[model samples]
Target: MAKLVDLTKKPYNLNADQIKWVEDTIAGMTDEEKVGQLFVNLFFPGSDEYSGNEFTNQEIVEKFHIGGARYKGQDSVQVQGLLNELQSASKIPLLVAANCDSGGDGATNDGTYIASGAQAEASGDTSVAYNAGYVSGREATALGVNTNFDPCVDILMNWRNTIVNTRAYGTNADSVIKYTNAYLEGLTQSEIIQCIKHWPGDGTEERDQHLVLGVNELSVDEWEDSFGRVYRNHIENGVEMIMAGHIALPEYQKALNPSLKDEDIMPATLAPELIQDLLKTKLDFNGMVITDAAHMLGMTSAMRREDYVPLSIAAGCDMFLFFNDIEEDTMFMMNGYKNGVITEERMTDALRRILGLKAKLNLHLKQAEGTLLKDKSELEVIGCEEHLEMGADAANKGITL
Candidate 1:
């Protein structure tokens, strides 16, 4: 096993009180609760009357005790109210997250729409990337969202990669590193937990992980020169979390353990050799490792639903993203722990990391004070003139053609 980082240190930065809180909180949790902390379910935008999804959302919170939620495009006030309700419903404070890949607009329709990574790079000013992150963080934080799954650091080397075309920074590692770090800097300054993503890199493969498993065919040396270098830089710089992609790297898998058969190769989301051996052990990424959405074909096609949840935790993933059936998945995890498929030690480790992230964001502290969003004035900053100008300025300077 890779030596786990001292949880109370730098990146996590838990004080003695916070440490005790996390420990006590974990100790108080039931197996079901602990398993619930390992998921970040999708939050549809609307109230009970309007969307009818609110009841299910409440059930996910009250029953499953979900750790976090991801929201995309909703009325700012309604979204905030929904999040507050969800947070209030949970015993532990929820770590609200969003697909703020491009900017805050990725999460909400009212948010500033900044230039995409490719567009940002075209301006030839890394500061635009920083501005993008800042705007994303500022707006997301204003709306009570603490996590942004963004700064897509993938090197778009494949011309045929449709999904990553404008999403990625650029084709080269140097540019990706520069822009990614700048973007992270902006997010960090705004106090939004940034998740650098699509680990082992994407865009080298033409296939999308949502439909089928993709492969980044780089050999060990090539990966180290490109994607490896970028990821290590972020990890060393104390990135809070990483989203492991559904893609696979056969070369790295073969290099790590040559005995593996062709059928054994699996998406990084379910591959212990990839997630545990490669990312945690070899890469020494002690921070949280969240899987890409389990509902995707890349994951579902590779492994059965019941097997993926427990196996993902056992394979060193701290959280599973999305859900096909929230209640069913939650039950599967609870049973996994009871059946000894997911060990207590493993469950504890996952909970510790999950709570540590919550602690890092001081969600526990916020929950205690009942001050998730201080005042509506914070919401006023969303899509304000200054932010829109920043987005427009970035586009004016960054867009190539």
Candidate 2:
């Protein structure tokens, strides 16, 4: 067993064996290296072009020791290049991930528009959901995406809820659980870590957390009755990570102690009671716990809103999925440590969780899988049937309701 490494306090201490591994094997990471573990950013495949503006490229990841990436396209080659660059560039090897919600198609166009597994279940023949998930995992694994932000476990409680519409299987918790497990089986069996998202259930909320803070109408017990099953079940089954969103459940919101209640129980990304207390303590999730995106207004950011990095840290988030707010989180957290708002202990705790998860991916001190470049012809399989068949299998075999 590897020696326990602690990051809760500064002047951190890992046993000598652990220290040698992190320092000697991990390119001698400093506090900066520890900080980089807190991020997972968006990717534009070929380079870094977002909204027609190119703010970052392969170089930024290399220079900053970025943790991982949330890829956004089907250009497998470009995705490969970016992943390879990000992983190879980091002072410590990186964890390359993406939001392959409906498979990589959600990430890129070269992918098939296989109906989300959730939609497949509603239409019957769970095979559709299964195949879609399976195919997507295969496609990504072949292309080099190590982790997938998928199998949206948000229980579909409100049919009128515009956001989750087709994203969820149905309002039935059992249905969601079955299909979710199948989706995970296909993806994890492929060796890609799957991140079931929008914790505490975003299905009951009518608003989209991306645009504004969303709220769940169910009380804590009601939520546990309806949707919390998905979250707990998945964690129990050993999912590697979970992404909390900007939605608030009144029960959770009302329970918050001072300093936090002022934020409206806000996004799960910024709430400690939700992230730490609910997720870790209550739900017993021991894997990686990441935020949706710091730049999202529904959530908090270091630039526009007050800096939320410290609060997110103190509350118990292991990583920040960044679409455009890395520098600020890095700079602000650095300041938090120096200024004393976020103690060294909190910093180390966050870093340990981050490092521990990435390490689970075998991404630090040890290189994980998906390093080989695909043959040019493998590109043809990007949106092909064998892959589609896999998704169909997932949908058919996985969905029971």
lDDT tens readout by residue for model 1, 165-244: 88999898999999888888887878777788898789897998889987899999999999999988888898888898
What C-alpha lDDT, on a 0 to 100 scale, does residue 375 get in candidate 2? 47
lDDT of 2 by residue, 1-401 (tens): 11223432222223454444544544455767666667776766665665454456665676556777777654667776666666665656666676666775764567755667456676566556665677667777666677788878887777777777778876788888887777777666576777888876777757877677878888767878877777778877877778887777667667644444444556677766777777777776666678877766677522244367766665577777773555656787667667776667666656665665545545543444544334456567677867666556555555455
> Which candidate wins on TM-score?
1
Runs in model 1 lying further than 4 Å from the true structure:
2-5, 47-54
Let me know the TM-score candidate 2 reaches against the reference structure.
Answer: 0.84
Give the TM-score of each candidate: 0.96, 0.84
lDDT of 1: 0.82
Give the worst 10-residue stretch by lDDT in candidate 2: 1-10
